[model samples]
Target chain A: MSALGHFLETAGIATAGISLVRENTELMRPPRALWVPFELGRPFGAPHAPAFQMRVLLSALALLDRTDGPVILEDFPDDAPESDSTASLVCPVNFPKPPNPDESDLLRAVLAETASLAPWHALFMETHGRSIATVSGLDIDAAARYAAAFLEPRSNPEPPEGRDQASTLRFAIEDLRNWRLEAITAQPGPKPSSKTLADWFWGETATGALALALHPVLLESTSPRLRQVGKGQLVPRAQQHRLG
Target chain B: MVRLSDMTADDAAHLLSKNCPSFPGEPFVAGPPLKERRVAIVTTAGLHRTTDTVFDLTDIGYRVIPGNVQAADLAMSHASVNFDRSGFQDDVNVVFPIDRLREMKAAGEIGAMADFHYSVMGAGWEPHEIEPTALEMAALLHQDNVDAALLVPV
Candidate 1:
């Protein structure tokens, strides 16, 4: 981010940016930056927080007026509002655990899970008027089937036209994960922290199990793209501990 | 919450070890006071309209987001999955902040919003590799008569 700032400022356009990683910003030394103390994905503090988001935005933009130096990096004074971590989100669906779960079993479990969560996901769309599940260009059912096809040892599913198999798999998985998260959050309850939601998805859900099962299959595949996805993209770095 | 000390050693090291290009000169062009500058958002959140193309692993190109984009129309295809996305799922303002910028314009905090904003995937390439794309975006901003760009990262 700071690097883009340097390039823009060098090109004669004034730039002010939010610095999520102060260390990185210090190295690049952008013309103007506000080092925020929030999490990685949220540079503006928190969701649905207009006033706080404004304060952060104004602080960053305010630096454009300062003529003090070529580089200015300041920190936001406060932390984001802490999420309700103590709140336990109960899964509305009761997925039956399959004994000696094989590829077919895992696929069936995932399909069942998605079918159960469909209504909740629909409710989420109705209330929120949007979803992050549109990346794959496949609806939930097709995404489930596309992702589940990877479970086969020798059969590689044909990706959507003009799309590579590896990327399609990644998008399908992301769609599934986002769809499930949206469904879970749509239930009537306190909003869970990202940590809580992650734990539930990775540690408890059938979709999580399917992803974990795909890791080795992808890593051992002949395709380098799939191997790359398996190495760092399929499972987040923070969730790698769940791998057996 | 995202302090390096709180993260796994490998994750923290990877971020810190990323190569950041250093330029010889520090160019700081002074813009008008807050209320007189035409502001635009330049984000590295891999955002684009839902109907647009998804970002590829090696894509360094950017997508143009109009000033009047709707929340439902936006989708993220950033290659990295390490960051939190639930915040964005709940509210686009968390990552995009277009709504807040609109409010600032309405309140005269800034002169006006640019007719177009920009978004690019922040991962899959070195920091220095963003120069060409940045230059192109800067030209677009200049054409739009934007004086200040609020660079947002996710």
Candidate 2:
């Protein structure tokens, strides 16, 4: 955004942006920015709350008049509100986690959950007219299999062409995450919080465990990029809020 | 709050580096005062009219949305699981806020509303891909005489 904001400013358009990540915003140093305390994908506070949304928008626009130069990072005063209820946000499908004490068990468990969710995913595609796999250009099942392949006693060491090994793992991980979210959100009810969904994925299911199990493998890779991406981005994102 | 001096070397380096911009220079000239300015919204929430093409997850490009379109007609195709979608599922004003902006204009909080707003996918990581799109959007906003823009990033 800092880059784009700078480009827009050069065109003589004044811009004030609401930022999700304080670190990224600070790095790019856009001319004007409002740093909100909301999650990564939400700049506005909450759904159905117009007054709050308006306040956020108006506050961001207010930065256009500030005398600060080059970059302005203003913190929003309010924290994001809590969700109204969990019962209201219940996901109908329940894929129980199999006992996963080791890497093999974790992989097997994740595949099992994936198998359970496949029918729901298909139904979602039928109803919504599109599938997550179609949009992401990844086969969720194939991706999971790729992750599982890492656990083989002697798996191929080569990364997919034009990409490193950890990058491949990260995309496969995201593909699996997308698949699970799609299946759960497909049911007719309020969507769960990201944390709640994460808990369900890592705790109730075996997804997070599988990712944690992959960490040593990623960290031990010969490529620096593979190790960096795994340690720096992938592991932190997937298991940042691990409770166990 | 943790003092800056107490931070580890890695944390400090990351913090200092984050303050740098690609095209570093003076800030843009602020437009007219808020009361007299024409305002518009541009979001990175992956919002679009249901009929429009959904943003590719990695698309750094943008889609123009008419300012007067019904909020109900909008849909979000954002790929990140980190965002909470319940609010958007009920009312897009939480992210797009076209209706609220109109209300502000009606009440004279701002002088007028721009004829159109814009939205772009927020998950893009590459600067080269995003820069051209931003330039294109700026040109369009310039044509509309938008004095000030409120950008909502998801």
Candidate 3:
């Protein structure tokens, strides 16, 4: 959005932005930015909180009055809604882990957990009138297999049609991540905090292990930007493996 | 409470290691005071009218959101778990705030509102993919005579 905001300014449209990831907004440095401390996807503040939302919008637009500097990142002076529910987030799904597992064992564990959550995932979709499979237009099982296939040492399969090798791989990674989260969200009672889901994916699941394993395949691609993006932009550093 | 300073040292260090764009150009000034300026909104929230084609998750392009649309008339296609859309699910004002913009217009907080707003799926891993689309959206907003814009990122 910072890039878009910059372009909008160049076109004589004064612009101000509300940011979710402060580091990202700082890097791009839009003309005027309001760094909200809210979670991603809820930039205006709490759901259904009109006064707060209006305040956020007004605060961001206030930046338009700045006449001097190239950029300003003002903090939206409000505490983020307390996420007390996140204190002890536990994903409900569990697949037995094998001791001292290899890549294939980890892959199997990931797929098994996905399959185990299929029924609950379907129920979650039913309530929302949507499914991740419907959104991506790929069967969940096929998507899992597609991602897992890349983890094998000698697979080197063709990329999905219309996408280059790196993009296809990237999409696969995201697809699996979303699926895992969907399953976790489907469990009855309070959903895990977004941070917990992220931690579990990177710290507790084989999915993260697979992503780390696939880092080399992504870097070995012909596109240097793809390498930089996959290693530098796409995956978090904790989930990224060092390249020689 | 979730300040950037609250980020773990490792996560912060890793994030700071990535390249970020720096601008040397002067900031654009509102041609007139905000009360006399025309304003609009642009979001990276993948928001669109319910009747429009939903955004492809990886799409770098944009969708047009009519300014006076209803909250029930909007839908978001972003699939990240990082955000809780319960608020947006109930009232889009929590994310897009077209209604609030309209209210602000009525209250003279801003002079006028554009007839259309803009939305793009902002989840793309590659930032370069969005440049052309952003430029195109900028041209359209310029043509619309938008004097200032409020950008919301989700």
Whole-model lDDT per candidate:
0.88, 0.66, 0.67
lDDT of 2 by residue, B1-154 (tens): 1223433455445445543445563457677878788887888788777667666446576888998887546766664544444455445666777878888888888888999888888664555467788778888988998988887776
Kindly report the docking quality category of candidate 1: high
lDDT by residue (tens digit), candidate 3, B47-91: 777667656547777889887686656766663433444445434
- Extract clashing residue pairs from model 2: A27-B18, A47-B87
Candidate 2 Cα errors over 4 Å, as ranges:
A68-70, A84-193, A201-236, A239-244, B1-22, B25-27
Q: State the lDDT of candidate 1 residue by residue for A26-105, as single tens digits.
A: 88888889998888899998999999999999999999889997888899999997777776776655656564457788
Per-residue lDDT of candidate 2, residues A35-130 (tens digit): 887754456777556778788878887887787676788999897665523733333335344444555666667777778777777676565554
Select the stronger candidate by DockQ from 2 and 3: 3
Q: Per-residue alpha-carbon lDDT of model 1 for B36-154, expressed as tens digits?
A: 99999999999999988999898999999999999999999999988888999999999999999999999999999999999999999888889899999999999999989999999
Model 3, which residues run further than 4 Å from truth? A1-6, A19-31, A39-42, A46-51, A62-73, A85-93, A99-108, A126-137, A216-230, A238-244, B14-27, B31-38, B44-116, B119-135
TM-scores, in order shown? 0.97, 0.63, 0.70
Q: Which residue runs does candidate 1 get wrong by more than 4 Å?
A: A96-100
**Best candidate according to lDDT:** 1
